[model samples]
Target: MEIYALYGPSGTGKSTSALALAHKYNINAIIDDGLLIYQGKKVAGQSAKYEKTTVQAVKRAIFFWEEHADAVKEAINHYPIERLLVLGTSRKMIHRIQGALALPEIHHYINIEEIRSSAEIKAALFDRGTQGRHVIPIPRIQVEQDFIHRLIAKVDKIFSPKKEEIGETTIVHPQFQTGKIHVSELAMKKIAIQSCEHLPFIESFRKVKVDITNTPVVEVDASFIIHLGQNVNDLANTIQQHIYDAFLEFMDLEVEQIRIVVSHIQIESPAHA
Candidate 1:
């Protein structure tokens, strides 16, 4: 079987990028944290994130137990997995998993830095360290089947750059993680409106809405009154990009869509002739 390995330090977003990478490379299966995810479903094995401690999680991730390795290996064989992706913290860890499953040599190695920018990696690490949020590259339903007790949230479906639907990711706060924080819709709404501050063309906001139902992925709708004679298309695009960048920089949230509406044009009153 053709194998690919993606490695980075823990919490650098390997799992978050897994489905997209797999879709990009046409890899049909992923071995992530002791779970065998095939075509966006968990076909076999337990999630290492379900463990009670970081040490146990590490052991599970590496397939320390013979039974765990056997189950995943059998599942791999059952499927026509022409190519597979394995995620780990480093090359050594990937090799351990490869040896445990007796899988073929890794034909390609991808670094998380290649898939994500430095700023993105920093944001991911902040989320892991401060928010205790970890991503699993499977649907929320799959994660719920095994770990319903822990708080779970769904991210909006991931899409490739060409707009192909890759898959969904579930946020799992591991048992070992502690503390919980919440960001309300009001805060997000304010951020969306505030993103327009630097643009002189924007006169005032008519309406602002933020959707946090999707957890880490947010949707913002903003309607604004703008100065007349400004390029509406350019202004809308600028607002979209500004808000999208703000969410990432300030909240570490991904904006799935930012809908910009030019509600009314504020034309200056003409002096009496």
Candidate 2:
């Protein structure tokens, strides 16, 4: 396979601009932060961003674990990829990744400064330093299964200069520092409750259980009473959709499973003459 490298310092928006660059060069796949992305989907390997500490994160990114390296290598060999873009914080890092994956010498090297303005780089640095947010060039659903629960995943849309939609990216803050931010169980339940309240057919929620046990992958169990004459199955589906959308759009949390159990049905009586 022909290998291309995008090299720059950390927190310089390389991942943010990767999709646009890939599109510009007609590259079919990308290797970023220990994940393999093709056609805007994550097809192989776990993300280094899921590591708990900065040291571990770095190691994971460089393919320190044998299993991680083997998995990515195997995927690369299995796919019919002709051109691949490898992202790294420096040229040396790119070489390490290329060697680890057994890829051929990089045909070209593209610097972050070449594609992004200084102001853009500064903004990305500030966000990384202050908020600890990192961008992954794959859609949220692809990584939601393995992403840690404490981190939030926001969908980021990238567009070319011509305003053509390139692809979707995900922003997440990994647990690489002490005193990492937490999304409380109560807060998640509140989101679920609010979602249920907005549905016209839902009279009131009997219980809203937000399960964060597996986290970043949440399971919601809700019990509610619906207004009479409403199609039970239809309303249940609507409620599920609303809750799913609310969590993803508002909280950036992925809801893996939503179970709606009808506890009661309320009906209004005819007025007396």
RMSD to truth, every model: 5.0, 12.9
Looking at model 2, the pairs that clash are: 149-215, 149-216
Summarize candidate 1's per-residue lDDT along 107-219 as a digit string, tens digits: 99999999887656766775676678889899988788889668885565899999988799999888977786666668877788787676766766767777544334434
Give the whole-model CA lDDT for all candidates, comma-separated: 0.82, 0.78
Residue 117 of model 2 has an lDDT of 70
Give each model a TM-score. 0.69, 0.64
Candidate 2, position 29, lDDT: 92
* Whole-structure CA lDDT of model 1: 0.82
Candidate 1 is scored at a TM of 0.69
**Tens-digit lDDT track for model 2 on 160-206?**
88999999988887777444355676887888778768665566676
The numbered model that scores best in TM-score is: 1
Off by over 4 Å in 1: 180-273
Q: For candidate 1, list the clashing residue pairs, or say none.
A: none
